[model samples]
Target chain A: MNAFLNQLPIGLSIGAVLLLVALGLTFTFGQMGVVNMAHGEFLMAGAYTAYMLQSWAGRQAVLVALPVAFFVAGLMGLVLERTLIRRFYGRPLDTLLLTWGVSLILQQVARDLFGAPNVQVKAPTWLVGGAEWSGIRMPYARMFILALAVVCVVAIWFYLARTKQGRRMQAVMQNRELAACSGIATSRVDQRTFFIGSGLAGVAGVGLTLIGPVGPALGTYYIVDAFLVVVAGGLGQLRGAVLAAFVLGLLNSYVEYWSDASLAKVVVFAVIIGFLQIRPQGLFVLRSRKLT
Target chain B: MRRLREAADAVASAAVRWRGPVVFVAVALLLLVAAPAALSPFRLELLAKYLCFAIAALGIGLAWGKGGMLTLGQGVFFGLGGYAMAMHLKLAEAGPGQLPDFMVWSGVETLPAVWEPFRQPWFALLMVVVLPGVTAFLLGLLVFGRRVRGAYFAILTQALAAAFVIWLVGQQGLTGGTNGLTNFTSFFGLDLADENDQRVLYSVVAVVLGLLYLAFRQVVASRFGRLLVAVRDGEDRVRFLGYDPALVKTVAFTLSAISAGIAGALFVPVVGIISPALLGVVPSLEFVFAVAVGGRYTLAGAVLGAVLLNYGKTTFSEHYANGWLYLQGTLFIAVMAYAPKGVIGVAGQVRDFVAARRGRAAPAVVPPARVEEGAAA
Candidate 1:
């Protein structure tokens, strides 16, 4: 029980990070139908952006680093979308290749600027330690991330359900032709979608710094996981993505307890393959006439 | 009168086609054939490794370029075949009834059940081809059977490649655990290190690649090729025409898997190594990059893409290992964003432009040779 308790923080922390990344991917896929393989690279960019800010402003302002990372990475994402991704809107494969190239470029840039070795981020003093709850000790950093993720997910859900722009985005996702016909600017939706997705990736990058060392290949590792989460959930379905992330999170955490991490990945993949075989449209695929 | 005109047009096109592409292939062949003599033994070996990569890229071209199945997981098939061949080579070196050095080092008293079949070279070779084909066959039957196309298929394949790498890395006792099957020697009693023997190995691989290319050319020119394109372009329409999209895709995917497996089998002997580094998700994506940059829909393009990009990687990394990835990434972006049809497609456009300026009728762009006959434009 104690051993299990000790491991929960790491698992949940990673899960929170995964959720943020997947949510970004979910938004993009939902709105633009682009896989954005470079989504993880965006996270890496954000992490680096945060690190750079910390160096300039010092570690005392790590909280301020959060919004700064979001702005920098989001701007990069906007540039990527307007310049490269927008041209290949309906062409999923081309977008995948192009973004992958972007990812490689971003990683190499980091390697050049930060060197090939891991760059460490000093955690804020307030969120450095852990507190015991129900005989289980969870780190404050992790709790901060978990709380942030919950708040983000809920906030996005409310915005999507209630706000005018959010509804327009949802409308565009549901039926682009119909949305356009009804005076919704699908192009604006695309821009907003890119911003939200990239912003979420930046947030996730900040969350990641709480636990792991920020490195060049950090995006390579998480991008695949995000893809798995998006696919295993339904493409473009936020709720589905959240659910899938949690399920995968719990499954991986428990599996890591008994097996080597590598083996756990294999088992998870096998399970996903099997699950996909059973539910090819994914666990929470939305029912729409346009799905075909 | 129409028949005479058609015959003249065909003859004229064929003659024009032979001028540029034939010259290119001839020059490429001369370069490849003369490379061992001109270059040092080490460079000769590195070039051999690139050819092995070309073999894998050929499959990607056929599957992605022609068949329209974005098989991002060719690495899994490549790794399966590589590990199989590596196992046999390892067993042969270990001699009768002895476990491979890594297994013994890892404290396995006896050979694992999975590694047992590899002791027989014939069985190992067969499995190298069969295993990947069967896996792809089953997977395609399931995924395509459910009509999972586009990004869904791509993600699934990538996940499988990642899973394969993880599995190989984790199985320390069985697989040598991430260090992968290395330090191999003595292929079927020949000295692998001998300069002459290495040359012979390269030539043999060259011949095999040539024959495989011809075989692929023949396969793509058949009726089946048309069906694959039909399915890729419009699956519903293909179904309306009485062709089963699932079956067509499965066959193409299986053939591609076998091709990748054969490449892996050759890679082990020619490259003298098979590690997770070569068959991981990164390598898989890199292979896809080669195909895309080379022009996935063209046969010569696939082969050329694989060879050129790999050479570029070696040269770039040798010079700038730390920052060269940016160049590679930039190349990918440029190729896709600027030339979706790839190098061959660009060449075709240039040819058309020259012909147009010369006040002659521009030759029709030759469809990629890897597509089945009816699918050819």
Candidate 2:
């Protein structure tokens, strides 16, 4: 029971990280239909942003890093949306290829700017240690991330359900033509949604720094799994991303406990493939009338 | 009889189409000689390596360009074929059932059951074609049968490739693990290190690629080819016309996988290595990249894309080791945005421009390929 408790935190922490990353992805990729392969690189950019701020501000950087990473990565996302992604709005494959190209460039640029090797950031003093009880210990970093993820998910849910802007975004997502007819500024909403989505990814990247070293390839590593989260969660559904992330993350952690990391990955993939076979529409799906 | 006359006319039209083949064969023969005479041995080998990629690209042209499956997991097939060939070579070198060195090192005293069959050259050669083919058949049956396609299919395949790499890396006892199988000395009684043999291998691959190119050209021009394109453009319409879109896609995908597998088998001997790194998501993406760069709409474009981009990579990496990726990345973005159809499409545009300036009748400019909507994963 004690060892299970020890293992549970690790699984939950990984799940938390995935949930944060997937939260960003679920909006831009899932709702808006933007196939941003560079989404992961945006995460990497956030990590690097956190890294840069850490050097400048020292131990106190963690507190400021989340919002800073959000704005920095969000601004980059906004710039990308306006300059490149806007042109390929309806063209998903082209967006995928173009964004992938952007991802490649971003990765190379990160390597050029920060050097190729992994760089470590010091955890804030507040998040340095762990909570322990009867030989079972959970790291403060993991605990903080879990709480942060829950808060973010709840905040996003509230924004979607209660806020005027969020409703407009949902309106645009559901029926763009109808939304445009009803005087909703669809493009502006797209821009803002992309900004917030990318900002969330940046936040996730900062969250990542609490546990491990930051590198250029960090985003690339998580992007696919995040995509899996989005896909398995069903398109344009936040709860699905949360549910999928937690399931995959927990499964991966438990598998990793039994075998090496590589085998664990294989098992996770196998499980996903099997799951997808059974439920092609994914775990959750929203329905709408189709006059076509 | 009317049927006999129609058959005769069919043969006649096919003969007329032979004009394209004449030019193709001429190009092949020219390349066949020019490769050995113009380039040094090392460069010739590198060209051979590129030709292997071109073979895979040809498959992409058939599957993606014409059939429109957007397969992003050709590397799995390629890896299967390469590993099959590499295992054969490794086992052959291990001599009459002594077991591979790595397996021994990993504490296996005898050859595993799966590795035992690979000891035979013929079985390995057969497997190079069969392994990827069967795998693709099974995968296509499962995925396409369920109507899974487009970006979802692309992502599924990408994940599969990643999973394949991880599986290979984890199974140290079976595979060579992450380090992979290397240190090959010979293949089929010929010394791999010999310059003459290297040229021989290069010529052999070049000829095979040329043959495959011709084969695919005909396949694309045939009536079945039209059906494949129809399936791509409209599945429901094709179903109304009494063709199963899923089966058509499966055939195309399976063919693509087999071609990638053949390329992999060739790659093992020319490159002298097979590893999980070459079979990962990145390499699979690069396969698609080569297709995109070459102009996925045309056969020659696919081959050209593979050769040129790969050559550029080797040259760029060699010359500017530190930051060549930046240039490559920029080039990819520029090409994707400005010339999404790649060099052939660009040339087509320029030709139209010249004709327009001269006030002559411009040939119809081909529009860029369309990406299907709602397939966004």
Candidate 3:
């Protein structure tokens, strides 16, 4: 019972990480319909940003790295959008292969810039310890990641719901033609959406450094999981992403606890496949009148 | 009787009208007779390995190129076929009741129940095709029936590959873990260590590839092929026309899986190992990469792409190991961005350009042959 109780926080933290990584994908893949396989590389870029910031700020780099990584990753995404992904707008599968190529190039670039070995970032002094309550231990790093996920989620919510630009973005997601007819610049909206989506991945990468290894190949490990979250959550539905992330995270944590890590992965995938069978459109579906 | 005679005459005329058979015969001769005679044993083995990949690529050409299902996790099927072949070979090498070396090393007390049936070579051979076929059929039905496709299907398939590798790696006792099933001495009584035997194996693989290419060519030229393309271009329209798009897609997916399985089975003997590393997400994606580079739409293009890209990979890695990934990435981007139809499409375009230059009245632009048929349909 105690072990099961302990897994709740662990599950939540894992869900938090998944949410952070998948949040950006919900925008590009879910809303914009561009399978930017290179999104994971943007996350890698974010982690590297944290690694770089450590030199300037020492142990305090993680805090400073968050905003910086966001823009750095966001700008990289914007450049990719303008240069190559722009051409393959309507063709999602082609975009997938194209971005995968971009991802390969970016991974090699990362490998070249940083030696192939993983680089370690010293955790902030505050995040090194853990807090215990009623015999359940919670690491500060996990809590920090969880907090960061919430902040990112709330901030994204604010951006999309409260802000005028966010509303414009939502409008485009709903119906690009109607959005364009309303004098909203759909192209510009696409750029902003891609920027914000890729930026969130950067932020997710920053949060990840506290828990995981930072390396060139780090993105490939999480890319599929992040994609699964978006896929299960239903495209362009924020609530669905959040719900799916936590559900998958809890399922992963519990399954891993019962079985081995590898078996847990297989079980999670099997479950996802089974879940997809029942709900092919995912947990939620966007209502649109446009015929394909 | 008159109508039947006319139909036969038209079929004969059509066969003669197109230069397809001449090209087919030329390629057949080159692969079966000329190339085997010219290349050394080592080079021939490498060619055989590439041919295994070509077999898988042929399936991808039909499914992804022609039918529009981006099957990114072909490695799973490939691995299934490979492991089946490898298991039988290991059992045969062990000689009657003895465990394979890896099983002994891993301290497995007895042959696992699953490995029991593999002792029979025929059962293993049957499984090589059946396992992946059934898996694809069920998966295709489940996913396609629900209308999940495009990037969703691609991502799902990729995740499946990742999971498969993880599963393979974890089962150290059953699967040989990360090292995978290897060190085979014989295949169906043929001594693998003998150079002549290896050459014979290569010939078998080459012949199988040739036969598969011709068979798949016929499939792509059939009525169902047109429906597959129609479903790819517009699934709802096909559904509205009273055809079940899901069923059509499932058939193509199953066929692709079976081919990939056969390729994998052939790959084990040709390459001499079947490991999790070879059938992971990266390798599966590489299979698709070969298809994209050659021209996904054409059988010849897929075969050429698999052979040529693999040849390029072997050569490039030998010269500059670090540059290969960058080159591969650039190639994928360049192909998708500019030459969507691949090398075959580019060749068609060049032919049209030259022909237009010679005849000023002719239009400069002509659609690639297969794509033109698809569009016209």
Model 1, span A52-99: residue lDDT tens: 878666775457777888887788888888888888766777788889
How far residue A170's Cα lies from its native spot in candidate 1, in Å, is 1.1
**TM-score for chain B of all predictions:** 0.89, 0.91, 0.91
Q: On residues B284-336, what C-alpha lDDT tens digit does candidate 2 reach at each position? A: 98988888888988889999999999998999889888666677667777777
DockQ of 1: 0.50
Candidate 3 residues B1-377, lDDT tens each?
Answer: 99999999998998787678888888888988998789998888889999999999999998998888888899999999999999998888898999999999999999999999999988999999999999999999998887788888899999999999999999999999999988877887678889889888988998899899989988888999999988877787899999999999999999999999999999988888999999888899999999999998788899889999999999899999989999999999999998888888887767766878998655554232221111111
Residue B265 alpha-carbon offset, candidate 1, angstroms? 1.5
Per-chain TM-score of candidate 3, chain B? 0.91
Worst 10 residues of 3 chain B by lDDT: B368-377
lDDT tens readout by residue for model 2, A209-243: 88889998898788878887887888789889899
Clashes per candidate (backbone, < 3 Å): 3, 0, 0
Mark the 10 consecutive residues where model 3 chain A has the least summed lDDT.
Answer: A283-292
Off by over 4 Å in 3: A290-292, B1-18, B351-377
Error of 2 at B156 (Å): 1.2
Worst 10 residues of 1 chain A by lDDT: A283-292
* Over 4 Å off, model 2: A1-6, A289-292, B1-19, B353-366
Local error of candidate 3 at B241, Å? 1.1
